[model samples]
Target chain A: MLRIENLNVSIDSKEILKNFNLSVDEGEVHVIMGPNGVGKSTLSKVLIGDKNYKVNNGNIYYYDENIKDLTIDERSRKGIFIAYQHPQEIEGVNNIDFLKTALMARLDKPINLYEFAKSIEKLSNDLKLKENMLYRNINAGFSGGEKKKNEILQMRLLKPNLVILDEIDSGLDVDSLKIVCENTLEYLKENPKTSVVIITHYPRILEYIKPDYVHIMKNGKIVETGDYSLSLKIEKEGFENIGTNIIEDNK
Target chain B: MNIINIVNNKISNSKINNKIKLKENKNICIDIIDNTKLYIEIDGINIKSNIDINIDENVNSRIFVFSNSIDSKININVNQNKNSNLILNSFYKNDDVKENTIINLNGYNSNIEYNYSCIGKTNKSLRINHYFSKTNSIVKNRSVSNNDEIEFEIIEYVPKGSIDCNLSQSSKIINLKENKCKIKPILLIDEKEVNASHSSVISPINDSDLLYLMSRGIDEHNSINLLVNGFLVNNLNLNEEEKHILFEKYIFRR
Candidate 1:
């Protein structure tokens, strides 16, 4: 459903992603494991069409359509969603209002307020978010866990076809992580065609949402691709121990 | 809530409500002796007026001043007695408007909270003088200009012997066009045992915030509109009806 061919991305004249390649089929779950500063998050930003990340080479394909020139909003309307590593705290923008606007834009039609409110209430309850949070500004004064849950709520509401979760488990507690993963799993069950790309530093979240493939990213490119066992191997012996032999063997 | 109207230097008091049609070159005086809430509407064109307000001791009052005028100059003076509390919310939209406001805390434990929002060419200055101990003041001003320049100067002064006073001033101006905007927040404290803070920002709508909103599939124009609405309407101490009126008249109309 999503394809990146020889993607070379840079910001401020410094290259971040060089010769990066990845592919995800419909209904596939791909987990990307990488250490800090390995350009994992940069890949996610590039996928979402952040203008700051200049694509110096290659193209991004969404369902075989080249989306390299699409704007951020255009990519979002095309069913591409990225849960940011650090969600922005926008003051004065009410959370419910923002979600309603987004939903309207995504559907390209005005929605029934009653249905929208009901769905928001149910989703807030499922995510263990306080009802008052719906009235507050977007992510303003929200705890780290609440911000992550809010992102998941938007994903469910928007029903994107391709989801890129950048370090979704960074600030979540055990229960919050469980709730978030369960919500995601429920969403996937309802929409079987949805594809997920999980970006993380550890295999903790993988225990909840099992992945079809695990790719280890280093220096802005995927070095090794394996099944779930690769995540466990990397966990047992850190990224430093994953040597050139393993990369060659995997290739 | 009492609604008072002064039209063309004439006063007609009703038990419930009225309107204010300010006349050119006029002086208006208002004295509040009891706890009351007031909604004052000042509507005029090319008028100059001076208003004096006095609040008696131990009284609590809230006033909302909605001014829709053009090419007007207005001066407001307010005095608060002991243990009085006042909340003033003022909104202005005009082609050219100059407003000067001075507030004096004449007694101990008096408090004043002032909120001002404006659009178009405006020059506004406010000074809050703390004359007694334990007085408090909070001043917040937000302005937006599409073409003409807008300037705001807020001064909070605490003289000597006015110990334990708290003063704060926050001012921001959003210049949508190429017009230059200014915000000057000054805090003059002669007392040692007082808390004072001031912050000011004058810029266009934040680009990162706009991008964040747009990433949710909202177009750039709508995203900017939402941001401008939030910047003007949020954090104002207004009731539902007042907020709706402000939104319809000033924010949405733009």
Candidate 2:
């Protein structure tokens, strides 16, 4: 479970989040739909403790703890995960190595490479990822779909309690989107205590993985909160018909 | 296990009778061999020395050298004859080492593949000189260095009128907790009809890479360790299990 109170985030002296507040209970999935420049991606990054977004006035709480003091990696270790819109292309950093290193970080002993390799192969297969890409540099030359699947592969390997997916369905084709959404739903089913927060401009993925709550972000704030029908409304009618102007999209 | 092992050096120029000769087509697995003195090749001999290989016309051979030492220097010269092919693999882990490998593709249509991996505990230097003497000779060199300096040089010459020879050099260096480390890859091509290119990377584990790894619950130091190990040892020609052991005992020190 995660909670935010009166959060105002800014980057380079430009305001991004204006008193944004939201809360998601355990075993729940929440989706945030908005037009361009509505701080949807910024909120996801802030939740994962990305340092680029400076919190001017706010406090993020996870369970009973105020995560304001936690570092980026600290928040990640505390069961907070974020899937970026564009995963970085890292050369010479193998996917298996990255995953195993992250998995080993929680342990005090040396990593069991053989078992780690087996688990990775199994998870990658479950995600329909190429086994060879696991050996290559992390997302170095991967296609957009491959990048999305790789993100899911990390989610499977990491199994964090709270998953934040930012534009995960943006670049995926129909088939890849289905695979990603199906795997995500499967992961949620396995971890009933887990929660998901997806930020997107389209509702196609909501058709695959329905959310219990939908929030429409505008002008650095959530202006409306409703159920899955909110996402459907934004899908049929654009954000303009949702009582928000294009001029107010970015603040 | 590594391909080459370094044992005690036996042949010294201090004595006058240090010249060593060998039979043709002979395969040797020893601690050390000083071909300058201990190896001799004569005509009409079916000789194939695995170490210090020399491929004559229409000959194809492969060699492996696995070396481990505190301080040593080994020089290997490979000469490819007309229409000949040679593949050489070298792996060395040492504290102080100075090694120079000279490869000459002198005959027409000769080809060679050379790969070397080295782990440096202290100050060490490695130099390689590759020569393309005749037409249509292809040469490739790949080297990996960890913890110290390496100067890899390749000189591809398409002797006037020599046509369509290709040369490639790739070198990677991982410098962590290492302040005195550097890599220099020099490619010298002397002909217009030849294709030659070289790339040398000397870098620490980048900050973004560390952040990416740490975002998955890995700490900063462990993230750097993982990145260094991946850069230095991944996708190499040696044994992964054996290399993992080496990392635990020696490289990782845990």
Q: Identify the runs in model 2 with alpha carbons over 4 angstroms from their true place.
A: A107-122, A130-137, A241-251, B1-4, B10-68, B89-93, B119-161, B174-184, B235-254
Model 1 error, position B41 (Å): 2.8
lDDT over C-alpha atoms for residue B78 of model 2: 61
Compute the lDDT of residue B133 as modeled in candidate 2. Answer: 47
Task: Chain B TM-score per candidate, please.
Answer: 0.88, 0.64
Model 1, residue A11: what's the lDDT? 89
**Tens-digit lDDT track for model 1 on A1-251?**
88888899998998998888888999999999988998999999899988989999998999999999999999998899988879988887778889999999999999999999999999999898999999888999999999999999999999999999999999899999999999999999999999999999989999999999999988878888998999999999999866364352222
| Each candidate: RMSD | 3.2, 7.4
**How high is the lDDT of residue A167 in model 1?**
97
TM-score of 2: 0.78
Residue-by-residue lDDT tens digits, candidate 2, B1-254: 11222233321112122222322233322222222211211111121123354566676555545454555655555666677665555555555556666666767777776666666633323333334444333333333344455554444444555667777767665655554555555555556777777677766657777777777888777777676665545534435565565456445542
Prediction 2 global C-alpha lDDT = 0.68
Candidate 1, B1-254: lDDT as tens digits: 66655443334442332221223234677777788777766666785667777888998988877777778787889999999999999887778989999999999999999999887899999999999999999888988878888988888889899999999888888888869788888888888999988889888888888888888899888887778767766757876577778878656653
* Candidate 1: count of backbone clashes, pairs at least 3 residues apart or interchain: 2
